[model samples]
Target: MEFSELLEQAGGAGLFQTLLLLTFILPCFMISFHVLLENFSASVPGHRCWTQLLDNGSVVPANITPEALLTISIPPGPNWEPDQCRRFRQPQWQLVDPNATTSSWNEADTEPCVDGWVYDRSTFTSTIVMKWDLVCSSQGLKPLSQSIFMSGILVGSFIWGLLSHRLGRKPMLSWSCLQTAVAGTGTTFAPTLLIYCGLRFVTAFGIAGIFLSALGLMVEWTTTSRRAVTLTVLACSSSAGQAALGGVAFALRDWQTLQLAVSVPFFAIFLISWWLPESARWLIIKGKPDQALQELRKVARINGHKEAKNLTIEVLMSSMEEEVASAKEPQSGLDLFRVPMLRKRSCPALVTSFSLLISLYGLVFDLQSLGRDIFLLQVLFGAMDILGRATTVLLLSFLGRRTILAGFQVMAGLCILANTLVPPDLQTLRVVLAVLGKGCFGISLTCLTIYRAELFPTTVRLVVLFFLPETRGLPLPDTVQDLESQKSTAAQGNRQEAVAVESTWF
Candidate 1:
């Protein structure tokens, strides 16, 4: 079926159904990709199939007289350094006898080799050892490849943000998905580390852009009342994706095979672009009133509302006008500081964004790289993240944004402090503290994302969100502004109420 028809069917079903499909499928794709990036063994260097063979080699058996012990010293060749010479002798020596004969040698020898050697059909046993220098040098490439991919994300975020604003969210999202598919597929065919890293960077750029645009489209399509729920659910897709990585990583254990596994999803999701509709908000903004009306009617029909056709351009324009008036102020970036209300809101949101990011991304990447059994850590952090999102959804009605945010910050800080202070000898307590810290950090991050979106006016929202200056006082371009705008808006309503109360009493 045509892509549009599939999307229409999916959208026509219900919000719950659409969310279920995306929640399930998108994360599966994402987790597979993440596993390939962070956990896939092929990305590690000096990991040729030969390494496994060497590790499985067994020592050849020898027949010696009862009083005679055969000892052969294998001299180091010209190519072997002192370090290389030592490894051949370091492995535990093993003796194998098909005849079941007994011999008087150390348990390290004469006994049937319990471990450390493999026997092939040729009756030869080999012991394999790796050259440490070669292994380290080969492993180093993986990090460089990952760094390239991250750099692409950093660049792609800005480019995609701009494109979504200029070209409309739907087109950008569709094109980005296609790019991701192509780049991802190409990655599986990379014959060299340089080629693999380059393709990965390209793939990352497309993936990053697709996510940014898709998120913006989803947010813009929903009503104000449902916005938080929709956004939170969408954000949860990322976590779900991380969870799926465990399975995908397990299935595609080899490096090249893993890359192929990762690429397949992007190709599948590309087909989704056909089914997805253009954003109703962007349609109205671009003066495509008829198309906007048609899309809105479809949503209304799915929602079982009778007023779908009645949602006129006039109503949309009025809403836009109100938003514009509310956001109207001096245009310069410095104007954010001129208003005390804006300043207060912006500062906390910005601080929370950076701090929460430091905790979340830093820990996640660190744990993944450590290559340890991190399931417990994952579950702990994942639960905390879900709980934090749920708390934001519930408490948004009762708690002021600033209060909730401040609480989150304090909780996170305490958890992190406990994580550092807990005695290392108390491994269980340390793990518990780490989980609490992760959970606290998760909630803080959710608060920041939700609060930021509510902070800015629609017209300048994207610009302010992506262009805001860093805590170090370094000014980024327009992209940071969009991120900053959300922070400012989240605190605006509370700050305004405080201002009004002060004015009445004064």
Candidate 2:
């Protein structure tokens, strides 16, 4: 019997499992919010260089309109768009620009903004852009800071993935939650850009750990019947978090306050971490059957099984010997590519994964293209995410994931393609189709993440691939022997059929 089967016998998809699933729901939302944080925090607001300059002791009037000031002290860019960086060395006074095109404009001496930029704070009261003047000559800092933040997530995924496997999931999850709470919330108070970026990395590291551990635990704790539904629910939780971020960002207006609002939730999660369970399946793999059995017995008791007290450790340990004996030598990531059939299948999957990722991020980064309130669009996008996952949950019983994936992908393509035919003046129709496309994309992304994890032969390298929410249904072949066993079974069936046909002819 496999460990999966033993877990099934011990009431895998019961009340205990539901309780365990609830423990991870908050962590799912917290980690997902980090993925969307940069859109608000690093956004460059409407800005123009302050034109005021002191000539000895005289003051330039402060009440001048921006248009008049720009004419006096700024040169339009080469395309006749207002220049973002350079300004005239000395004011020309608006009276000189009597004509739109004149020789004087061509020969005007210009210098970079010596007096820093002034930002319009109508929507965003404070952001990294407004606070640090990451505009004009320093515009590159906005994207650079974001790049550093993403790099932290990339590196953290590897470290936390390995650490959770070595140090156990619950401990890593607890520590991550606590660390993220401290480091992330503390970032709001950082007085310098360098310190903020440093804290952002720490926050990324901790959240990565929390995300991986919580997701792994969620999948491991549930039975196959419940795994997809649980993952779908977690996906919805993530969308809700993103929606909450959009709404809170709209309300708070200041980047620091929004930062604190999002970061503080993890501390509450740290306290709740006490209730989360370490993977009993992993415990059994580690030769801790006694501990695993205790966890299962508690599960059985919560599930209202009277026989739980009599359920000995043997029930959990029974499958361990076969698992250990059947285990193969560890394979590196390249091995998946070394196998011909695997590579053929993987190439298309890789391309598809890349396409899905680009489309997902492109939609997220450019949500305002739909011509609606950014806050409302984000909430609708989140709602669409919720709708898509919920729809997937309902369809899973009637449709295979592969079939549903194809349908959703096709729908996404059609929606996007149809939008191109929509007239530019028909903003409402364009917005509707775009929203539908986004929803289709949301569904496709959710399915692809889970599907690929199930598709791949588990190898050390593949561990770095799928990191969001997860579902566990099919077990990966642990050894080449397992494949050979399957081949032998097919061969024996073929032989039996041949014998039966000859017997019938005779």
Candidate 3:
């Protein structure tokens, strides 16, 4: 008998699985907050060089409006808006006159702002740009900071991704929760740009660990029957968090407070994570049938199984003996590229992930270019993600993952490409196309994540859904050999037909 059969007797899709799925929502929410925080925190607002009254040491008349004063001190940019970076070397008082039509100010001596900048605080009270004077020559630093955060994720992905196999998902996950809580909260107190970026990097590192461990634990614990819908619900919760962030940022307006608001809640989440069980599959594979037995019995009891007390280490070992024997030696990430079939699948999966992320993030970071209220746009984007991912729940039930992934990939690319061809005068059409493209893109990403999860062995599987669980209700495969030989274990007993239908597609 396979582990799934044992799991069924122990109460598959029971109370334990349901609670574990629900527990995942908050961490996903927190992840969304930190991942997208740059939208509000680093946003650039309307700004111009700070203009001072003439060197005569005379105070300007109080009646003179700031806008009028700006016209005299700052030249118009290419679009005839007040220039952001340059200011008049000497004030051209004539430019303030409504009747003054001369373009002579264009040739007048100009220099970069010597003083600071005057920011428009109508939307954001303060952002990184306003805080660190990151406009003009310093503008590159903003993107650089975001890059630093992403780089941390990249590094952590490799680190935690490997460690989760050896150290166990729950332990790494607990450490990650604590790490994110500490580092993310510490970001609120950073007195310098360097310090802020450093803290953000560390927070992102923890975020990677959280994502891998949390998702791994969720998948490992859940029966295949509920995996698709369970993941959809998790994705929906994350999108909800993203939508909520728009309102939160709008209300708070201040960057530090917004950062603090999102980070502090993880402490509670961290504490709650302690109560979660380790992946029983991982334990059995690691030669700890005793611990696995205890966990299974615990799950059976919590799931209200009357036979819970009957589960012994002997039963647990017998059930997963094949799985345990196959995992006698640990697998490494290199095995993905070293083994033949794994190499074939790994290359394409890696490429697809890289491409999808570049496009998705490109669209996300360029939200301001849509020329709408940033807060509303954030909500709209989040809503689209929810709509797209929610559709997957029904789609995964019928369509094969490859078909959905390929179709959405083509659809997303077409919509985004077509968007660029549309004239700028058609603002509404542009926004519609942008939103539709993003929605399709979100769907494609969801497909890729689930698809990738089905392709590898247990060692790396915990990191990326490697060869553990197949699509639908297949039992978790413990080795590369098991993965290659996988058939619908969902065909056991009376539920065979429904599960066969679920697992039939690639």
Q: lDDT winner among the candidates? A: 3
Whole-model lDDT per candidate: 0.51, 0.69, 0.81
Model 3 — which ten-residue stretch has the worst lDDT? 497-506
In candidate 1, what are the lDDT values of residues 49-153, reduced to their tens digit? 211213433542344431121121111234431121122233222322333232423333222212222212121111011212223334465456667887887
Which ten contiguous residues of candidate 1 have the minimum total lDDT?
497-506
TM-score of 2: 0.83
Q: Model 2 over residues 329-366: C-alpha lDDT tens digits?
A: 45444555676545544666767777776667766766
Give per-residue CA lDDT, model 3, range 398-477, as digits (tens): 77777787789889888889989999778778778888987898788777767766666676674422332334544555
Measured with C-alpha atoms, the lDDT of residue 401 in candidate 2 is 61
| Total clashing pairs for each candidate | 33, 0, 5
Candidate 3 — what's its lDDT? 0.81
Q: How far does residue 290 in candidate 1 sit from its true spot (Å)?
A: 3.0
| Candidate number with the higher TM-score (2 or 3) | 3
